[model samples]
Target: MIDAGSSGSRVHVYRFNYCKEEPQLEEEVLFHMIKPGLSSYKDDPVAAAHSLDDLMTRAVKMVPEELQYCTPIAVKATAGLRLLGKDLSDKILNQVRSHLTENYPFPISANDGIQIMEGSDEGVYAWITVNYLLGKLKPSQRGNSAAIFDLGGASTQIVFEPVFSTPSEKMSDGDHHYRLDYGKGDPYSLYQHSYLGFGLNEARKHIKERMVDQWMDDAIKTGRVYHPCLPANHNETISYTSKATTTTNSQPEPIDIQLIGTGAGATQCRAVIEKLFGKDRPCPTSPCAFDGVYQPPLTDTFKLRDLYVFSYFFDLTQPLGMPLEFSVAEFGALTSHVCDGTADDLLKHVPGAWTSLQSAPDTCLDLTYAYSLLKTGYDMAPERLVKTAQKIGGVETGWCLGASIAMLDGNQLCKA
Candidate 1:
């Protein structure tokens, strides 16, 4: 399985055992990534498809030659391509399909095999990956399953099996609700939604644009704008791009300017990030998350279920002395230390994160955004315990494994 994400493209080659009713993931034969994702070559679809050659070659070698003819291959592009709109994304997908079909020994389904994955399916697949890895999909662990919060470059997703108290209670009809049977047990009624523009990288771009809008005149005059989200002594040139698109174009040239850091801490940075949520928008449906999107109350629906947060959530926290499991309040405190302190202060308090801060000065903003995203955006409780991990057991944590299972179950490639 190939995950063509916003920041990069990753390939996961798996060898599964089909002895059980459900396919058992024996081992992840190969896992590799290439940067500047397929979307980077927006002007040239061929190059975008060609970018996977190295990774594909490596993956092909992982499967035994005898089984190559029976193995199936697929490419699923995420928000990166989704943001490119249909015309351009389709071109990239077609090129990718042609490349794989013509060269690889692996089987590639003519339809619905290599394409841009729907946001809803990405979330559901990731939910399955986490739960299955933790052994929560077994019949004995039915009610003890966990929820998932995935934060990517261009989008964020939340998914969980909401426990309804009354038989009459039903999740309101919308894109946020998903029902599925993992094939081992009864179908699950899950609450899932993918927020398109609320991802960490996308949020940074939105914040930069807002800052430029507020400080444009001053920046143009002095060539230096003060930004509160960055740490002190951190200065850099950043692009503030507009989301507006014309009939022929999806990404417009950005407005670039020099930014000087003020290190004002999480208070002001949180305020800036909060405004993007559209919290004030009128919600026709009750119990809404940010941007007037419907959500079953997290507190009640997912009361005792464990919450597994990965990707950006794990990347930002683990280096700062945060444990695998921590409460919302603990995360907030770490955000404060990172956002409010300087380079020297970081060396004194969070020495391990100092080097990372220097490389990415917007560490403060990233940390603050993550904390606020959970505390304010999702409205999670201060005491809520969430686990962060890049891997579960020996397998890397993401949606690829689960997607492989789905394909095998459909008899797409696996004959067992």
Candidate 2:
């Protein structure tokens, strides 16, 4: 299975045992990623489909020659393609289908196998991946599953099985509620939602757009805008194309804006990041996350349940020498320390800080956004503990493994 994500495309090869009622994942044979995701080649769908050539070639070699023909192949594009609008996404998917059909021996699982995935499925599948790897999905482990928070490039998702006090205290009918029956145990009534334009990269873009808008007059006067989230003395250029104009038949015009860093640190940057949550928007539900999205109150529904964060959350925190689990309050403290200190200070105090900053100057901004996302957006308690992991038992974590399991079970159950 190929996860055609916003930032890149990743292929996961797995071998499973069907001795038991539920398939047992024996091992992940190979997990590889190729950069510059299909969405990057918006103007060249052929190039986007071809980007998976190397990864596909590797996958073919991993399977035995006799088994290759029967092995199921699927490509599930995420928020990146959804953002491209239906027309472009459909075109690119068509090319991907042609490329896979003509080049690979593996059979496409279904007619709609090579297509963009729904955001809700993206969240639930990832939830499955984490819980399954942790062994919480087994029949013996019912009611012990953890909630998942995935922060990708173009989107972010939250999924959890809420624990209610009474059988009558049920979730309201809405898009946020999903009933998942994996044929492993009792069906899970999960709370899941995906926020578009809220992933690490897309959030950065949205935040930068707000910064440019707020300081446009200054930019017009000085030819540069001051960005508080960036490191001191940092300089960068970002492009902005209005979402309103993107879907029109005519090509959208993009504006280039240069930024100068102010080194405002975490405290100040958190305030800026919080604004992007759209807290002021009207909420149809009594309690909602930012942008008026419906969500069961985390404090009550998910009390004492383990929480796991993935994607950029793990990628950023692991380099900082963080433990496998830490309180949200501890994360806040770390964010402040990193944001207030300089690269030289980091080199002296934190082992990998300097190198990380050198490669990604937006470290401070990323942390600030993450912290705010947990505290303000999700209303997570500062003292609540959350786990982060890129891999478990030598297998990479995300939506792919769970997606593969769903595919093996049957395509209809995995449908949007």
Candidate 3:
């Protein structure tokens, strides 16, 4: 299955066994080279909409037709959807919707007679990934409680969920062992949230609006694009620690986020963590616990990795007069040359080899670009974000598995 995301898209070939009740991985790869996200619409959405046809054509080429497994294929679009105006969105949807029906045998389409979701879909995916990380998806498992905070190029979401161990907990069947209630929290207290901000572009806008003079100063000196600022000191870190959770509050605890996801600039996050600890959080010295990363979504599996993502969210700023190609996925540099936000920037990760954006050698740190946007003008962090991600997972890939559940029936309904 292939999902078109806000930045690019990905294709995965997978199989599952109902008897074993688990999905066995087959093959997967991220096809970011196509860059088929709605971000393309930023310049000329109408033209971008048309361009999707080309992207789809490329997507068609990525999959191998000879695979014989009868897997249910799906195509999902995330954060990027909201970027397009209705006219452009509708046009793009209509075109892609047609392809959904025509391509990949049993193509998964969110348009047509289908529906798309927000937090719920992502929540379910987090459930699966967390299960995989926790090694808890036994046939006798019910579910788990988690807070998901996902930041994407187009949108961001915070999901809250209380997992029910046994899928058939209330069923009158004798297979009662198929239910699981792990050591997390109270079951049946699921919740979630979604925010349009917290993305690279918007976060950048926030930084620029808040530090216009600083950005212009950089532009004048460098005469180049200095994207995504990086945090230079510890005082600038932003705390993702949650203030509440169902376990801690009478009103479902309202999940307080203890983790923040980088989504793009995890490598930078490692730097922040190291600078704070004055030690290499990841490998070379010793993995801080975040090394040997997974599909990027399964970050929770690592312990003590509480502050890895959020390279730009802290509003960090860089000194003018630096390299030209240095880029960041927003969330960089602090409001002041020195950051006062220690709790906001940090996230969980076992110290290890961090992943960088676009892995090419040319891209360095880009907190300055984001700072310029923020100093200019844009929305701040979305409301009720931390809580939502608790239920759902961060937005990257695999959110579809959740969407396949929560948003399927317009509510949370597990697919048998």
Candidate 4:
């Protein structure tokens, strides 16, 4: 199974036990990832499909050569492809299908093999994966399951079995409720939603656009514009086309602007990023999550249930030597320490913490946004315990495993 995510694409080669009544994940034979997701090659669909060649080669080697012809392979793209619009997404998927059929040894099972997954489905898959690993997927364990919070580049998702009763009217909305039937004793009803423009990268883009608008206005009056979220020594050229401003012909024109950071620590950084959460957006639902999105109150359901946060959340936490499970206060303290230092200071203090210089500039901003998302967006208290990790019990904590499981389960459920 291949997961074409926003930031990257990953392939999971699995060996399952079909002898049992229900297929089990016997072994994850191989796993690999490549940067710049298939969606990055939106303009060139063929190249996007070809990007999987190296990963497919590794997959071929991992599976038994004799069994390769019978093995099923699939590619499911997430928010990245969804953001590309239907025409481009279909073109990319078609290219992937052609490449796999013509070049790969695996069986292309059906017409629906390669497709774009809905945001809610993505969340449900991750939830299934974590619960399956945690021994919570059995029919007897229906009520006991962990809530999943996945933070990606282009989107974020939340999925869990709400403890409180959902109104019949609300449950009728397909986006709010999803039924998962694994051809088992009983099906599971999940509350899930995928919020676009809320992921780490998209949030950064929104925040940067706001900064550019203010900076450009200030630069006209003053000679300089300062960015509080970046390091004091950080200097970079940023280009953006403002929605508030357009050319005389009403077409948006890109403008390149210079940014000089003024070392404004966590407090200021949090203030700037907090604006992107859209807290003041009108809420038709009495209890909304953010930007008037209907979400079951997390106060009662999330607090009582086990919560697992992964993806970018784990990436940011792991580099700081933080525990896999920690409270919001501990997370805040760590972000505070990170905010107090410049890029040089961070490098000097936490040697090898950062993998790239490009990521270093936004360390403070990223950490601050994470903290705010928990506190302001989700209303998580400082002492609420949230588990964050890249893997659980030697298996990657992502949607790929769950996708494989769904595929083996005959793809009857989770059609969305």
Model 4 residue 110 lDDT score: 61
lDDT of residue 94 for candidate 4: 96
RMSD of each: 3.0, 3.6, 16.5, 3.7
Per-residue alpha-carbon lDDT of candidate 4 for residues 1-416, written as tens digits (9 for 90 to 100)? 99998888999988777766767777788889999899899999999999999899999899877778777888999999999999999999999999999998887756357999888878998998999888888777778899989889999998888766554433335457888886477678788888887999989877766777666777544434578888887887767776645889999877666777877888888888878878899877656778777777777665667888899999888876678899988888878877877444555555566554356888888888888888888778888899987878778888888888877744322111
Using lDDT as the measure, the top candidate is: 2
Q: What is the Cα root-mean-square deviation between model 2 and the actual structure?
A: 3.6
How well does each candidate superpose onto the true structure, as a TM-score? Answer: 0.93, 0.93, 0.45, 0.91
Global CA lDDT computed for model 2? 0.86
Better of 2 and 4 by TM-score: 2
Query: Which residue pairs clash within candidate 4?
Result: none
Q: Kindly report which residue stretches of model 2 are placed more than 4 angstroms away from their true locations once superposed.
A: 241-253, 342-350, 411-416
Give the winner by lDDT: 1 or 2.
2
Give lDDT tens digits, candidate 1, residues 30-109: 99998989999999999999999988999888888878888888798999999999999999999998998898888884
lDDT tens digits, residue span 123-176, model 2: 999998999889888778788889999999989999999888888887878989
* Model 4 per-residue lDDT at 391: 75
- Number of backbone clashes in candidate 4: 0
